[model samples]
Target: MGRRSLSGKVVVITGGARGIGAATARALASRGAVVVIGDLDVEPAKETAAAVGGSGHALDVTDHAAFSAFLGSLGQIDVLINNAGIMPLAAVTEEPPETTARQLEINLHAVIHGTRAAVGIMRRQGSGHIVNVASAAGKFGFPNGSTYCATKFGVVGFSEAVRAELRGSGIEVSCVMPGMVRTELISGLSEIGFLRPVTAEAVALGIVRALEKPRFDVFVPRRLNALTRFQRLVPRRLSEWAMRVVGADTALFHGASSAARAAYETRVHG
Candidate 1:
């Protein structure tokens, strides 16, 4: 199939002030897409947008009304990337109820709402794409990140159902599952053997490639897709064993105590 041109496409991204979202904005802009960023930190968002020659707005993804208003204000959205998410890792038994609720709101509910809003607008325009950024945790459970895993799992399922519903509607849906990314989100995370964290720009490029060639499941490193598929074919016990051998079991727990994560944890939890 011929590659689709992104030139002049109006792309909207949430949580685009930094990390993967910001990287995606810059990448898409370089491809000639008109990128607009919405983030809670509006100043950095504006700066990111300015660097891409796009507009920026303050958006709290949890607020449905505000999110809707923000998208409505943008004349036409050819692509909506539901990239706003938070990861506050903790054991399910020790995780705070508030943290669970926040994760559900930001990681799952916001994606749902953004996709719904974009669908309505895109239906009228008759062409659009929605990218929901999930995580590798969505596919495999990890210690000290039960709730975070749940929310991402929800995103993956939700995106799948929506993609089915939007078929033949000229609206493409993509679910992005990236492994541990080298960002503030993993500030204190220890490296896992063979599963070392990837750069945000790598994930950004994955998103860009997905846009250029519409695919349902987008794995950042690409090899992860094969690994995940192979995981399902193995016995559950074997899968668990592999997880342990890779140190995926205690990475988050160790990160929870790391002083390097203090600032990020405080900002998210507070």
Candidate 2:
């Protein structure tokens, strides 16, 4: 495949009403890509789209047919950013089963549905890019984010397989692993000494870079890839001790305040 410019390309971004998704929409739109924002928050999506001189629509990623229909309405697409995800932090035993299930449905299953909807169109066009946003937890597990980690790990693995399967077909797949972006998902959480969250704008740049370079995986901050690979080489006991030393072991629990938990519960149940 040849290197392509984003200018004038039609790009669709899921969950584009806020955070990294919204940032990506703004960045890509500025680069001349025709951006389309989709989210359950229809009004905000429209507002975001209007701000970027794009368009917005309501989309429930869990519904497979809705995903396909939205993609079909676009006619032709140059890129699809599977950016819709939710992170509700809780200890495995203390968390509600329904909440965990909902997290998986949104973070993992929705990405799958979005990819399935876009892959066919891209394959037929013989040119496109698919960017899936995974997290640092996707590469390594933490105490309070088991379910979120599971979903992201699934995304990493899924991206690898799909990239290989689509090799030489002109459709490229990129997995973006970002560490602690300052997004709404972690909003209201107390700032920790060790964890410095980057801006959503930074991660958005990483996504755009991945699309231009067509790499299988792009880690925001770049150094995160080193940490992710190093974790795998060390023994489990040492890794656990390292996590404790860095205060990652308790970061999620301490950060997930009662209000945050309640907010998630209200969103999922109501």
Candidate 3:
């Protein structure tokens, strides 16, 4: 229940090659944890792990057997961070079914796979922590991102229910909801003044803080939670209008990749 130290701890992170995952690896390593980065990009994973004086492996979180095997290879795991995700934006009706499925697989299914593996190790040891890197979209849905929202919302729900189920098991589960962070995932977008993405390092700090002081929910900026909750309290119409005025609806739309647009077109017209 009190603060915990990372010294000599064993931490495993999915999608740790870059972005928030890479930053979090560095943060945990600095705290004396032995970090292991798992990512599809083998070279980058090795590079990141080396930078943090840890180890890296090529991992596809979607592969249940592989995920389980990776954890089994490690003698013990003190912490597991489910940070792998993909965001493909398109109108609900226009979204490609394949893309939607991939989104759900990565953002939601992967968490379940990784958590199951980690919980097994943690339960046997009687002490562990799991950090799920969900997005603010998990809390509040935005237009043109129905599938992404669905996957993240699923994560939020899964994290809460599991945290409650794991009570007194010496395992803590924390759901991290970050508004926006500067990452390659959204590199095409121009920064909006109010919805500007926080640095990946800042989000990493929040993750480490959550680890030390276990909490069910963690917001990167901390204050973003208030705004998100307030939006839910207000009238639906007001919330919709507020989001539009703040450019939330068009945020990812404007920066959508060419491939995304083409997928939507091909799926709809074909």
Q: TM-score for every candidate vs. truth?
A: 0.98, 0.94, 0.93
Per-residue C-alpha lDDT of model 2 across residues 229-251, encoded as one tens digit per residue: 77889998998887787777776
What is residue 191's positional error in candidate 3, in angstroms? 1.8
- Cα deviation at 160, candidate 1, in Å, is 0.5
> Please, what are the lDDT tens digits per residue for candidate 1 over residues 1-270?
877899999999999999999999999999999999999989999999999999989999999999998898887999999998888877788888998898899999999999999999999999999999999988988778898899899999999999999999999999999998998899887887767899999999999999999999999788889879878999989988877887778768766778888778777774
- TM-score for candidate 1, please give it: 0.98
Regions more than 4 Å wrong, model 1: none
> lDDT (0-100) at residue 211 of candidate 1?
93
Best by TM-score: 1
| Alpha-carbon deviation at 268 in model 1, angstroms | 1.3
